[model samples]
Target chain A: MRITSQTTSDGVSEHLFTLDDIPGVIWSPSEGTAGRPLVLLGHGGGQHKKAEGLVARAHRYVKDCGFAVAAIDAPGHGDRPKVERHERLVADIRQRVTQGEALGSHIARYNVALAEQAVPEWQATLDALRELDHVGGPVGYWGASMGGAIGVPLVAAEPRITAAVLGLTGHESLTEAARRITVPVEFLLQWDDEMVPRDAGLALFDAFASREKTLHANPGRHAGVPAFELDSSARFFARHLLEDGGPAEVEESSARLDRS
Target chain B: MRITSQTTSDGVSEHLFTLDDIPGVIWSPSEGTAGRPLVLLGHGGGQHKKAEGLVARAHRYVKDCGFAVAAIDAPGHGDRPKVERHERLVADIRQRVTQGEALGSHIARYNVALAEQAVPEWQATLDALRELDHVGGPVGYWGASMGGAIGVPLVAAEPRITAAVLGLTGHESLTEAARRITVPVEFLLQWDDEMVPRDAGLALFDAFASREKTLHANPGRHAGVPAFELDSSARFFARHLLEDGGPAEVEESSARLDRS
Candidate 1:
């Protein structure tokens, strides 16, 4: 692991790391710990490790919940090398739009390929993080859209992940991945997502084998996912991974959302 | 500069080259040239230097036109580390789609940013290639979409280039770049390009200061461009770069296209 750049903010530190070709950012809480839980965050497709949502959530996990957070770019995303097929896909989609054709199969193929390619990479990243001294602790996950697509299969296979917050994505096939995930989960859903059907999101949520799972459905399009939901998710990981937070913290967050 | 990989087919040799993180592939004819003219080809957005379109053109220039061909991935593309903003832009587009909004601004931004950042990198690759003994000769440029966006500014400023094939992209604001380009040009335009307005493309062509310029309008959307177009582009480069193919050859190709 190499630290290419580091930024310190209000006692929290953001360290940019590169191992082989994998580029990632690690955010450590102000109150550091040797065995504190870590949040394995992820960015949506076409996003890098430091996307606004991922960074905001990482900060919330670190500052509000005292959990260390980290994320890496998915394949053909972020600082990683651009894949040629992705470029081909971009051109095809652009051409299709010009022809006024619906992007049904190409979009589906793009989503499936990106998510499938990223799962093993996420696992490799988990292994790399675990070897670091500060990361020797429990882990959770937070991802949306393409990130959610990847997280489902990842959380299913990665036993080290104790919990996950996934949303803004759904394909019936993804339910199979969700069914294998036994970790505590908090799934977000936009009532009128233009890209992902509501039923697909619900189906994945329903498929989760975890005894502790909750679906937070809000009114809005895909981009309309409420901001407060991130706060609740931060609390969710805090309850599962942190020493201080538990059922009381989780219940309080639900109440706050109810009031909002 | 290093040759990381090499493959031979029939009498042609495809060699992958890398220099300080810039990854490219060079295609050579059966009978190599010590100081052969080299075509600096570029790939479209989301593509690496070895994009199929680019590879096909490179091979055509090498095997068919008898000129050495080379291409380097643009910045934030191929083997180079991606820019952080590109990742953010991608996420923003995905989120926007979920909201069922037009991607006018985001797509425009993505195209602009990728092109602007690529110009300097293209210049550097040219400089690096010039130092190699096998690459000592006149150079030409071939690019489309994001490739053309970068090529306009590059050809406008880089006097080393004698000719260029630029098209499939246009923004009125880019005319300023076109205005400075005085090299011989073969500009291709897809009549019904979905991404670039037809007027923008024509306007950019009109802005070009080149005394020797021709517009090749084809029937099709962006991807509907005919394969014969690439052949013409190769012949254009050969007419300008290869000593054997000169004014007579250029006139012959103009006649060939006229009849077709």
Candidate 2:
């Protein structure tokens, strides 16, 4: 499943790398030939390589911030072989449950399995980025919704990610996955969003193992993502990936205000 | 533009009324020939007539439980005529903003316009539903996400609607369209969901001048509406639409609490 790297006429380098022998796409800036920091991007449900808006944003990050980005289509979505339609996937789960499968655990397992298969793809993309001369060292991750779900497991299992930003997604463990992630994470929450419950998101934030985590709440619906928030995400990535270790001095000073 | 209704099949005793005025297929159960409550059902963004999972669940209060249902598609989605490609739609907003249209106001207008166009279709659908002996009486409204946004304007503009149930949709008063809505409202919020911010949702809830209002907070993400919550929505709709004079017992309790 290793994807071979190819250079386009535009001089942008592309590659298919395999992890767990699973295939994934890697994109690097044309100017950056040397090693640089990599940012792994994961698409949400029913999305493919170029389908995610965040992926395009990730490209901007690579160009403006001098980082490489890698993204992969998940199982039953995008370029990945479609084993079943979304309805069929749900039906299969239902059938299995009717046949005695533990419904709750099965749902969790299904998500984990889907995430596991894509892990190698993420790893391979990371490997390709690491090989680049412009790539610094290690990598970061950014995901939205379903991609946010995968980012949790990816960061938890892979220590290579230096920082993570999860937008419009949260869970309490795999029961609510947000709680399981130990990394320095930033979560973007939508208030009146119907797709995901706010309390579940807050629970995930509460469960995060990192003391440095931050939460930003914005106004918008399921499809709304304000431009300023995107800027905030960029700032978070820059702070964690490019700046020196520990919270900025201002943040530290504010952190000490609870002494009273 | 008003659309007339016609009967499709007569021999079966239950006449099927059809309205070709709207962009998508909409149907109503022929139960009442006269004096039945009119219920309008709105589908979320990127959804069509049947709205199987989420929309269907929301529509239960109007359909299986009691109220007559009228379903319509949103703009550039479902059976509606395509206005622009997905990327183009987003790009158009950006273009408009660059030309001096305030970003928030423009988005609200775009959403309201989409809903307004669909209203004629809904009116036509209601006309068709009225053709049946089973449908009569005051209209009630129900919608989730984008549907909620549309319902807000529709209920405000149309005095025919007696009540409404809006779920999982809200934003700041950045748009004038949002400011016009005044209705008996119920808001469902997810604290951690990233698609919409809770603060923005709360602000919208506060903006409503409705004497009757309810807010529910749960744990979930933009895509994670658990089965239990779906059932709660059914109850919510039933309380407003199906109950004898709008759940007298609960209202009394609420009133008592208010006085206390």
Candidate 3:
């Protein structure tokens, strides 16, 4: 991984990094985070890792909770190489819209194909992140919309993630992924979403095998998610991940390495 | 549909039914049956309705249990028109075999694509079957392997189906369909299957939302499904579907009418 640039202000540090492949941003407690909890934040559809909301969430985790946060662009969603399938999906979606069909199931099918690629890429990125001493910490996942769908399978397949914040996604029964995830979960759903159906989102929540999961539902449209939901999510992750500082004694010798 | 030919033997009648589009066979108790149950049977990969095993199962359900049984060829299996996707899947499987890779996930993806089309066709067939006066009864589904995968979604979508026998199919995690299936399910898993991994099959069974589900696992390869499992399936359907028949009083006028 290459650290493209870093800016330190007050008690938080924002760093932009690219590994010749995965380009992402990492936020750390500027006072010096040796080995702290790492939260992987996932972005929604048509959004990038450094979206304003995600960046704010990262700052909340690092600056407020003394944790390190990172976000990577999922395949075809951000600064990644474009694939034909993504273009095809967009074209198909446009055609379907022209034909006046609801886009939920079509979008779900397309996302399933994309998530199949994104999950493994996230796994690889996680594996790579472990090489950085300061970033080696208990990992938690936070994502919604496309992020939730991708994170569901990612967390299910990767055991390192201990908890998750999933919501704002409407239903496409992905119980296969949800049933395999046993970590504590905080799921958020917009009850009156214009996009995803409420039943499908709840179905996804019901699929999670987590013994402890709280559903955060708001009576707003898809984009009208209540701000309190994020606060609840922050509290959820802090409760689960703030228990221990992993290998805090590990040296920060390679923490600031700049590959470029 | 046209009843191409009919023959009575041992107090049971076998009829070859054909439409210009769909070809299938129907077997029933020959004792002037009009109030018996109807069971839709699906054959495994590359097998036809008249395959020896399917035929035996049909006879078991028809003669032994006094239920009407029917089976139709899937879009590209049996005598139906071949789809390009099916050929591509076969080629992909062949290539994977040449490269010595695992087949379970690969097969699952291919079958998922095929089942997306198969389920709607099965729904149409079910709609047509309801028009047949002598064939109207408590509906049950019996399918194994690829048949199981297709039937899972079919039975889930068609609420008219009261019970199902699904087995030998392993992990494509079509949990969307499985979750919607609330009927009693008899799922069979081959413990030592060479093609599908055991977990995939069990995962498929686990994905089912049925409150009443019995899993029958045998220590055998894919085709090594125990002979008596069919008997168990026959009994399961009998228990669920042998009750009061549905709309059996409708006229037989459309029973033999071929749309072609």
Candidate 4:
């Protein structure tokens, strides 16, 4: 879809946006209440958002479950600067390898920078949402493959993120990124995948200490996400991000809880 | 090294060669008293001959154990057709893929063509090799990753190949091609690799019902082939392809075999 800036709910305002310079389409649901919760989506390696089945499934979850979603490209992927031309991106990656930085630490720093840049772009979108008087404040994140790789650090660093779902990605230090994720997390794996081995995927899952964590595995390949698993991922984000009858419910309940 | 033609003491006498068309150096060891056995070395994905430790080790076995070696490039890989326009390559790939062909199968066809094309160019080189008197006959084959994928079909179809070492690449079927390979085989795998998952590799190995066979697994990633595995792989081919040895020695040898 064409990336452009526009406002909804009577067009009282406008937002800034751009086409994913990468190879995928990012779709923001047109039907969410003002102040609704926001969920961000990321894509995998050699794949744009449109290529990853999980990202599209995630959009469904946010839309039907009553949340706004923001899908963006990962570094050296999607619309972000090409890994070859972006010296900072390359140097950052080199530093991680040369210094022997923990996988988690390296991923955290890279993801934070990715989010820092994209989050502002998202802010304008969120601002438009906030102006609509329907969107919520609690933001969530989701990704698969390289997208999942970026999702981890983004959620961990951004305390505002309420929950996350990562698929076909997440493993122990790839080169040197040790995964130390704290946000509520969910992981999905393919039992007989050739692109990414199952053991590595499991090791990444085990490293996380999140009490609200889940692992899902199904028969598939590196090429596509299974349909059943996608449904499960949607259910997960719904439980944490969309429950409470939308932002109005949270706003109303917080007042009562604060009074009590 | 530049690609050139070469002939050997093998009864076949003349064979083409091209060091410039492929990524690594080519060495033609002197033939034994009898016709020298030929061993072709294949490389893994995103890698050339020198990148994988096993390729060099295999070369050593060919040298010390009396076997001839020819290391060639897969399509779109190494030095062959290096200056071709991207559009031409993509169109060729699309044409192949549209015909319901795997990238490897097309690559195998391309490699065979290159081999045939190099024949005229390699005549002088072959004459020099014959003067040096190395390699008694046609050629045997071995490869990992893309090399392995190409080797599977090539060995099965080409009668000149007496045996093969199929490293990290294999799949159940390749387009319209299906046949039992008559030659002896050996397969290698990395237990924790994220690329070319172990299962797909194993399936390819199983498809080859070689009465004489060996399987080895080491701790590493897609690019992590240890220096020692080559010795084992070479030993495998040596037993089956070398004139002095046979299946009986393979079964008796203590090569630290891992069936899984």
Candidate 5:
């Protein structure tokens, strides 16, 4: 891992770096972070690692929970070079959007492809992030829409993530992955989401095998998730990640951290 | 209203009382409650004012938020004399339950009748409670199942109530009343509810005219609402009832309190 730039603002240290060719960023308290928990954020389609909402949420997680947070550009998002296949997929989705046709199948296909690559990238990034002195503790993932599309499979494949806040995208393509997940989950759904049908969202929430999953639904379109959810998310993460807090297994796992 | 008995325990003062023919109970901080907020809990069917769940929740509200809470026996329920009509309704419902027949229509009819008598009794109780030195403040309501059934109409009819936590019972009978309510609401739904159909619950939540409504859905049967919901309810009431706490109008209305 190579640190490209570092800056501190509002008591949070932002570090931009690259691992091989994958660009990513990590945020922590400006003061020394000895053993804070970590949260990984995945941005939506057409959004980058530092999307405005992602950055605000990162700040909240850092300040409210004293947790280190990180985000990385997906294979064709942010500063990453767009492959021909991804370009074609985006073009197809955009055309469908303009034609007022359903985007579920196309979006799901694109998301599946991204997850195939992004999951491995996230795994590698977690391996490297854990090696850092400031970012080594129980981990959580927060993502929605395309982020959720990718996250369903990633969380299924990654054992390091103990909990996740995922929703806003739903497809049969992701059902198997969702069923395999056993960690606690807080899933958000927009009741009137234009892109995702309400039944599909409800069905996806039903697919989660996690014994401690919750669904928070609100009245809005695809992009109008209520602000109070941020507060709820902060609490959810705190309940699962912080030492002397959350699940006993989390604290037990922290005790087992090798931190070598 | 006449106070029949009063006891103090666990930092909460419990008072048993009667207004006319109505029997009820009130809970508040054992210490003098000067201007704390108030919450009204409506009990479920086959249960009374001092039902185990209602008493537990009342203590929580008093201890956690320093709020006064109250509950009343609905007509033909809990220390109230059962009339021939109520007996016939109960017999019908019991038979339906035994035969595995749908009880939606029968239950809705029974709830509608109870609400008519219950709403007036509640308003009278509120009027009397607010006259006490420790019980005058902004008002909220919490009830589910039959409590929700009666509560839908009561909250709709009572302008003094500014927010509510209601769910677990859904039917067309309550649709009109639900639409008339504009207060902030937190609606709960058990995904696999045995009594209420999923669509009916979703429809009722959708019928609420409150601009700020949230739906918390979990995978469980009707009687399996998770315990964390109690904590969430306390925060919801706190946000809407306390001075400088919730909606602007609630505070404005409190300032308008004559206290005569």
Candidate 6:
């Protein structure tokens, strides 16, 4: 692992690094480098580690929860060399989108291939991230769409992840992996998502064996998830990752309506 | 309107009152009786305004948000006299539960009848409550199951309600009312609810015309909504009601991932 660059802004310190050939970045509170929660972010397809949305979310988690956040480029995403096969797949998907054809099977097959390679990369990244002084507490994973496609498999394989907020891409290929995950999960589904069928999303949510999983469905296309969900996800991570003096204490009420 | 009794406990003042023939209760912060948000809770069937769950929720809203919370007995519930027709309906529903027969249509029919009588009483109660100093700000409604049955119509008919958190019971009968509601809504759906069909619940969420409606579905029976949802709803109300110096400002962000 090597740190290539570093900068500080708005009380958050950003560090860019590479483990072997995998390019990644980590965000933390500049002043406090002690033990704090760490959140790993997986960017969507065609997006890199510091995608606008992921950076914003990382900043919020750092500012609101005082947690360290990190993101890494996928196998052929961001600064990595593009694979010819993935390039062909992307072109085919764009063609299919123009033709208005069903994308479920095609995307599922492609994501399965991506997950096989990316999961191990993420595992290695976690191994290196834990060596840092600021990142030693519980861990969380936040990713959607292709990120979710990778996350479903990673969270299932990695015991270090205690909670996750994953969604957008749900396929039969990932069902088995989702079933193996027992951590608290908050899944997102766009009601009118054009790429992924609605039933497929609901079915994936059902496949999670976690006793505590919540599904948040909103009305919009694939990239149109409302901004409020960011806040909701922050609270979810705070509940699971932070052990003391956090927002988790306020939710321990026994107030439930009588089911008549 | 008359206040028949009053008590203070845990920093919340609970007042039992009657508006004409309708029995009701209101909860508020004991010290500050000035302008604040008000939330109206509708209890489930066979339960009353002061149901244990409703009181707990009222106390949280008052203590946490410094807001007034109110709940009124439906026509045939709480301290009100029972209607013979409603009595027959209750017996029939209990019988169906024993026989394990389908209860969707039966409950919808009964709820439609109840809404007709309850909506006007709720409107009158709102009209009376607004006269109180602490209850003049934006209003929100929280109800599910039978409460949702009544809330769908009440929120649709009353223009004063700016936001709502409703779910648990969904049928074709409430479709039109849901379509008419244009305010922000947070809907709940139980994934394994025995009473309400999952499709019907999804359809109800689809029928909402609000530009900012969200659906939060979880794994459980009809009454198994997770406790975290109560805290989530409190934040939803605070966002829509309190215009300044609240938790709403934290959600404003422009972070989003680019979809490939």
Best by DockQ: 6
- Tell me, per candidate, how large a share of the native contacts it keeps: 0.00, 0.00, 0.00, 0.00, 0.38, 0.46
lDDT against true structure, model 1: 0.75
* Local distance difference test scores for all models: 0.75, 0.58, 0.74, 0.52, 0.87, 0.88
lDDT of 3 by residue, B51-169 (tens): 99888888767754568888888878777888898889989998999999988878888888888887877777777666776777789999988898888889988988999988888
Once fitted onto the true fold, the runs of candidate 2 whose alpha carbons sit more than 4 angstroms away are: A1-21, A84-87, A91-110, A124-129, A175-177, A243-260, B1-260
C-alpha lDDT (0 to 100) for residue A123 of candidate 2? 68
lDDT of 1 by residue, B131-176 (tens): 7666777989988887887788889878889999988887865778
Per-prediction TM-score: 0.47, 0.44, 0.47, 0.37, 0.91, 0.94
Candidate 3 lDDT tens digits, A155-187: 899999998988766544577878898998877
Q: Look at candidate 5 and tell me the lDDT of residue A131.
A: 89
Off by over 4 Å in 3: A170-173, A244-260, B1-260
Error of 2 at B6 (Å): 80
Ranking of candidates on lDDT, top first: 6, 5, 1, 3, 2, 4
lDDT of 5 by residue, B96-171 (tens): 8999999888988888888888898899999999998997789999999999998899899999999999999899
**Model 1 regions more than 4 Å off:** A96-105, A247-260, B1-260
What DockQ results do all the predictions give, each relative to the true complex? 0.01, 0.01, 0.01, 0.01, 0.30, 0.32
How many backbone overlaps does candidate 4 show?
Answer: 35
For model 1, how does the per-residue alpha-carbon lDDT over A95-138 read when each residue is reduced to its tens digit?
A: 98889886545665676777777888888877887877677778
lDDT of 4: 0.52
lDDT at position A125, candidate 3:
77
Residue A67 of model 6: what lDDT?
88
Kindly report which residue stretches of model 5 are placed more than 4 angstroms away from their true locations once superposed: A246-260, B246-260
lDDT of 5 at B185: 91
Q: In model 5, state the lDDT of residue A18.
A: 100
List model 4 lDDT by residue over A132-236, tens digit each. 344455777777766666666555555677787876764444323324556667677665565466667767765665655655544456655545345345545
Q: Which one wins on lDDT?
A: 6
lDDT of 5 by residue, A1-260 (tens): 99999999887899999998999999998886577789999999999999999999998777656789999998988999997898899999999999999988898899988898999999999999998999878999999999999899999999999999999998899999999999989999998899889988988999999988888999999999988788678768878888655422222322222110
